[model samples]
Target: MSLRIEQVGPASSARLAAIHATGFDRPWPANEIASLLHMPASLALAAYDGDEMGGFVLVRSAVDEAEILTIAVHPDLRRSGAGRALLDAMADVLVRTGVTRVFLEVSTANTAARALYDRAGFRQIGQRHGYYADGTDALVLEKTLQGSGQDGA
Candidate 1:
């Protein structure tokens, strides 16, 4: 499939929310997504297959550090490289803005996501107990940027 990743704005909140809802059990509302997108520190990227949104990644950066707030891919489109592309696009944007590291939390039970992060060079740095709505532990992972030649970019 041909997937194009692009920086998105508040106007794309509904589409992001829709795609997010399809991937997660409890999705953020469009207004919440819009509000986050409107924040000065917030950045979002969306992956589109032509006119349809396939996935997205949202982040908040502060100084040289950034945290991935959320990442989601359409249920029917998982494992198709859209997630990796979104991450790569996000890293490209982050590097341009002087970000040196990116961090995110994934559920301990999500082996697929954990594997994806591992393959992307993220290392486990910590963990949070009962961090999810379902009382699952969250594994905190971090990836240190390596110049502008990294895979994600």
Candidate 2:
């Protein structure tokens, strides 16, 4: 459980793209990941087990709120706490960046992800029917960070 979560840059886009492909039906390409890395207020983090990539999360901020654009943990690393580590680190970074609230969408059928979000203190705020390409419903969740607007100490 020695997962090290670090902020990532565009140079890791290709690696992130590769890791993303493992969990996504339509994973983003390296160029697209690079584009996101360059966007204003966008940030990405990678969780590593020593030198091995465990997962990654990408988010974008607007005013006092942030949206998780995407998050992926390698199938082999699922349930190994990598996902939770990534989420905790994301919140810390957001709080320092003045992001007070965070939002994300998870498939209604994704019990694993839903459980994680629930344990992380996110609440269901909305739903989008047939939001996925496979016609699965998506549940929108939100969490407000405590002690937000702090310096990135």
Candidate 3:
């Protein structure tokens, strides 16, 4: 089945945490996700097939800007268009909410994610040294939304 994107709340925190644990060594706990979901600016979107989760993307907005807090696809679902779908879905939300610019940080070692963002029109503007616990640098990418995103899937 194809993945479907849906807005989620604090109730989905445990499930999100499970998926997050698969992607990150220092994954946020369920309580942390729950607390973020309770914030006024936070938005969470889950990609699911029927009731099974494929991935999730979480972001927070302030004024005309937004930042992607996290985005992950199940290991089994990688390269299945899940990440692009979530990104496109998020762009729609940000556009509707009048967000003009979106930003995200991805580890320089995460080539797949960097490629994805490149395809989506995010350009690297700077770098954060030793941003990850493993001493990996992070690429700070930003995309200026002009009514839509490039390669929105």
Candidate 4:
């Protein structure tokens, strides 16, 4: 089914946390998700199939840069386009805010997620060892906004 993307609001935190719990190896607590609402320049977009949240992407923007704090899709609904839709929605929001680039780190073992970021034009710029609680390294990926990159690629 097609999903609708919404800008996450105060009432959406519980649902976003639920989606994250269902998708992650170690999920953030509901309160932690709620706290994001208070962070300056933070924005979240949630994807819904009817009344149910299917995925979400959280971004924190500053100056010319933005970082994707999290992106998660319900396990059963993955491999569909929900994740990409959420990312695109967040990117659009960032663009309007004058963000010139975005960065995020993905667990090295999350091949599917890495593939999605790569397909969306993100390139690995570096890595962090033992970045996850389980000791998995994280690959830092970055994507420049169109017309914002120095190389203009």
Could you estimate the TM-score for every candidate?
0.95, 0.93, 0.95, 0.93
lDDT, residue 100, candidate 4: 80
Query: Across residues 1-153, which tens digit of lDDT does each residue of candidate 2 receive?
Result: 688999998999999999999988889999999999999889999999889987999999999999998999998799998888888889998888778889999999889999988887888999999999999999999998877422222
RMSD of each: 1.9, 3.2, 2.0, 2.3
Per-residue lDDT over 40-60 for candidate 4, one digit per residue giving the tens place of the 0 to 100 score: 788889888888888999888
What number of backbone clashes does candidate 1 have, counting pairs of residues 3 or more apart or in separate chains?
1
lDDT of each prediction vs. the true structure?
0.90, 0.89, 0.91, 0.85
lDDT for residue 50 in candidate 2, whole number 0-100: 85
Instruction: Give the TM-score comparing model 1 with the true structure, all chains together.
Output: 0.95
Cα deviation of 102 in candidate 2 (Å)?
A: 0.1
| lDDT for model 2 | 0.89
> Lowest-lDDT window of 10 residues in candidate 3?
144-153
Residue 30's lDDT in candidate 1: 97
For model 4, which pairs clash? none
> Which residue pairs in candidate 1 have backbone atoms (N, alpha carbon, C) closer than 3 angstroms, thus clashing?
88-152
* TM-score of decoy 3: 0.95
Candidate 2: clashing residue pairs, number: 0
